[model samples]
Target: MVKSRSETRAHILETAARLLDDEGAAALTIRAVAQAAGLQAPALYRFFEDKDALLDAVAEHVFTTYVTGKAAARDGDPVADLRAGWDAHIGFGVANAALFGLLVTPGRTSPVAEAGLVVLRARVHRIAEAGRLRVPERLAAELVHAAGTGAVLTLLARRPEDRDPGLAEAMFEAVLARILTDAPTPTDTSPDLSKLTVAERALLAEWLDRD
Candidate 1:
């Protein structure tokens, strides 16, 4: 009864991610992961050379997943793309609350950090280009990302009884609106708002006018 290499690796990664979400990164020790995965400590070494390797793998997975989903949301219209992206970000953050917090928290850094930032910047460019985002798109993206990330982190930080689901969703929607309206965009060139159909422009204008 021998597990294939891929199977062993998958089990270890899944077990490690779950432990990280449940108990913070501290619970991802080799022994704990091994016990949780029903494998011995020595068996863990076959998948991950050490805890650093495992943590890096976890960070990479989280980063890649978030970036990929966000990039895919940048479809046709910038406004629609951004709106969809905002929803996706909120959903992912809420669903993977602990892991999302862990990956974004201030103090921790892993091998995935640099690569993640690079990918994030590229995604920002896509949204900025489509939306004709004003200010500086990169700066705007950073701010929007920070606010969105912060909201999710704070929500998860609260006690279970204190959590307010509706309030959180509303807050995200409100912040997203603000970010779209006021965040940096390409101001040097005149925006092609006319590219929108009459009905589309009217709807956009109405949305822009809302408080």
Candidate 2:
């Protein structure tokens, strides 16, 4: 039975995504995908020109879903916007750890990466503009993503017996608060070291003495 072009494309993407989620992105291959989809290896060529093309399609699918959901969750306030985005971003990573891992890992360039960067820049710029941050919006977005990913990695690395969902959520919230609040304000005056306690001064001196 001959399948329609859309059906074939959908099957390929579904198969690829499953492979990505179940076995990591490195396991993705035309032959494996075709076998998973119950199609001959040549049939995959009709949907994707090569393995990179197939991977691009899967990345696009995952990223589009992510970006769209994030966009929908945005509210007008910049602080609130940042909070919501961080929460959703971390939540996605926790829920879809394999897919999230695949998306962020260094790999071939694709439109999926481009699309994610575009949306993230826009969101980060909106927040940075509100705060008059000196760093570029893209840099801010990259930092935010890196921090969130680090937290997710910590959560994922926990042993199954030691994993506590509530504790992880609380820790994520704590980290987000520190990131948003402790970040320097461009025009804010630097605090005087003279005002610190003796212990604080010693700690500061120790830090300053570090290479």
lDDT of each: 0.71, 0.72
The C-alpha stretches of model 2 lying farther than 4 A from their native spots are: 65-73, 132-138, 164-211
TM-score of every model?
A: 0.67, 0.69
Instruction: Report the Cα RMSD per candidate.
Output: 11.4, 11.9
lDDT of 1 by residue, 1-211 (tens): 8888997887788888889888877677999999999989998887788887888787677656666765663466555555565566666777776667666768877666556456556656776666555447667667667776777777777876797777556765665565454654445676778688999999988998999
Model 1 lDDT vs. the true structure?
0.71
Relative to the true structure, candidate 1 reaches a TM of 0.67
Top-scoring candidate (TM-score):
2
Q: Which pairs in model 2 have colliding backbones? A: none
Q: Total backbone clashes of model 2?
A: 0
Q: Whole-model lDDT for model 2 versus the true structure?
A: 0.72
